[model samples]
Target: MTSKRVFIYAGGEIDPISIKSIKQDDYIIGADRGALFLVDNGIKPHISVGDFDSVNAEEFARIQGFSDEILSCDAVNKDLTDTELAFDIAIEQQPTEIIMVGVSGSRLDHTLGNIHMLLRGLEQQISCFIWDRNNYITLTDSTHIVEDRGYTYASLLALSPEVTGINLEGFLYPLENATLKMGQSLGVSNRLVEAKGTIHIASGLLLVIQSKD
Candidate 1:
């Protein structure tokens, strides 16, 4: 399964502590500064896609020596960002899932851009997730199984404006055939009541966030 997974390291805030959850054999793609992050985390990226602008020459050389493939781009007048470019390479592999790290940080614009990548993957019918220390985010148009993995809370939001006939099983605050809207906070910060949690959606897309406070 690791060979079929693609792990993306983006040029955002990274905490090595959270990397323990990542599988060792997944194909790693480094986006700009993420190449350095990979080195710090004791892993060399399989493919690195980025312009050399963000990384210094010496460090870039070090990363190149460690990387299996390096894709260099221009710093000016680029259509896609470094992270987006990495996604292109990951998608080409036709993997089972794409897990992206170092995506959320102080840069609001970049964070929003990272989210668009998830939507694109979703359109491709590929499983995509943006993970951090406390958040495990995934989107689905149908039902999903949620199990207790030490996640303290769970939230469900309508990613497609209107998610109808929503039913949540084994949740502390269960919802039976409820309608979740885009601009609603009714489905935020709910906990699990059992070892397994189940969510059923009849129509529209749903974003499930299993998180720890």
Candidate 2:
């Protein structure tokens, strides 16, 4: 039997807990300085894809030696970000799921952009998640059952214009057929009340953020 291929994108400032959660069967993909983080943690990337802009010349050379495959991009001109490029390579491998780590710490704009890339994988029916020190973020359009074993606080945000007919079960603060609008904080900081929780939405896109303090 073939083992599932899990891809990890090491950005910067990877949480030790998060690193521990990463399985050995997973394949690592590094994005710029993210490559350095992976090497620092004694992980050799199966494939490294990024522009060397954020990586120093000496560090980039060292990372290239560690990577099985290296794809370099232009520092000046580029359409896709390094994270997106790494995602493309991971998709080519057709992994069971892609769990991105260290993609969310420093830059808010980069974090948001990486989150948006999850939608691309959604279209391909591949589960993708962005994980950092505090949170795991994913996009969902339909009903999702989240087992309470892994996460502490759960939040559902409207990614589209509006999310209607939102229902929550087994949550500290329950909602029935509620409409969650973009930029609304009402859905934030919800706790799971049972061993499992269910979030159902009749329409529109939703971003689920499962976090720990």
Candidate 3:
């Protein structure tokens, strides 16, 4: 049976955590060269997406054999990025949660674009996360209970121009009805004092990042 969770892997910097998060029941999608990664790792993806311009004929053929479904488009004619195309497919299933992996890398534009894609989850009321070896990231517009998942630091940032009435509980540096403005580094490197911390925001979007060196 298909699970309520969807995991989309894109061509980028991958870490063990991203691969390790896969479970037997997960609906896995490989975008472009990401399919090669999955197939090489001995896992067949449910769907393979993108124009796959990054792969050679042999690799593409291997991905075709390994994937149950394929969604392809012309690389030059397509408007969406390969990762966004994979995300579009994932959103169609209306899963309870969507996890994006291998979307962050040396390319600053791609990384930031992927991060911005999390806003779609907030708009659709679906939980979304970007997972990497050293960082786990999500966005919220309201109250949220953040559990410490063995990460050493938790940070909050205002995704909008400003986030108002922010309150943090069980954090080493607690805030009370404070405001956070974008372009400020005041919220960086906070630690969870308790096993679970609470972040409440009255208005605007906030990005929560849990990371470790």
Candidate 4:
């Protein structure tokens, strides 16, 4: 089987540790200023897409030459955010999975907006995630198995009315056949007890967040 292609978004406030975690084989998609982040980190993206609002003139000029392809858009436009536009391009490439970085931090509203994009990807059955220094977030509607490495902590939150028949194993606190409601904090701060764990939800959509110190 072919390995999944991982797409990284260049946003502001990207953790260097997260950038290092990117393997040499992973694909990269830069969004506006995110392209600048890749250049600073000594990595050239496979494709760069967005309006060059956050990027300064010099940085934008530099990356324009390094990227495999550049898809420029108007700085002020309707329809989708720059990040979403980049994601659309990523989906077209048919990556097995996508990881968005530099997406969370500095602006709470923008972070929330990107999180909603994960929901949209979930609707398309695309395996997508949002990552930063302390958090790993994903949206899911069906049963999924999450492998726990010792690096981060994990939790599940209901995005819909209620998530039913939820099962969690190999964690500090495990739950079975439980119901998680929206706006509740019942599933927060769960740690992996074993090397790996699984989360199974029979119905409804959920947002899974894995964090570390």
Identify the leading candidate in terms of TM-score: 3
lDDT tens per residue, model 1, 1-213: 434888888878775765676676688898888888887668878988888687888989988999999999999979998989999998998888898888877888987788667878888778888877677788887788887878888999887889999999999999999999999999999999999899998999888888886
Instruction: Let me know the TM-score candidate 1 reaches against the reference structure.
Output: 0.91
Who wins the lDDT comparison?
3
Instruction: Residues 62-177, candidate 4: write the lDDT tens digits.
Output: 88988998988887765787888887887776767888988888788888898888876776667898877788788888766666644567878898999999988777898989
- Work out the TM-score per prediction: 0.91, 0.89, 0.95, 0.92
Candidates sorted by lDDT, descending order?
3, 1, 2, 4
Model 3 stretches astray by more than 4 angstroms: 1-3
Q: How close is candidate 3 to the true structure, as a TM-score?
A: 0.95
Give Cα distance to truth, residue 66, candidate 2, Å.
1.5
Ranking by TM-score: 3, 4, 1, 2
Instruction: Answer with 1 or 4, whichever has the higher lDDT.
Output: 1
Tens digit of per-residue lDDT, candidate 3, span 79-106: 9999999998999988889999889988
Off by over 4 Å in 2: 1-5, 149-152
lDDT of each: 0.85, 0.82, 0.91, 0.82
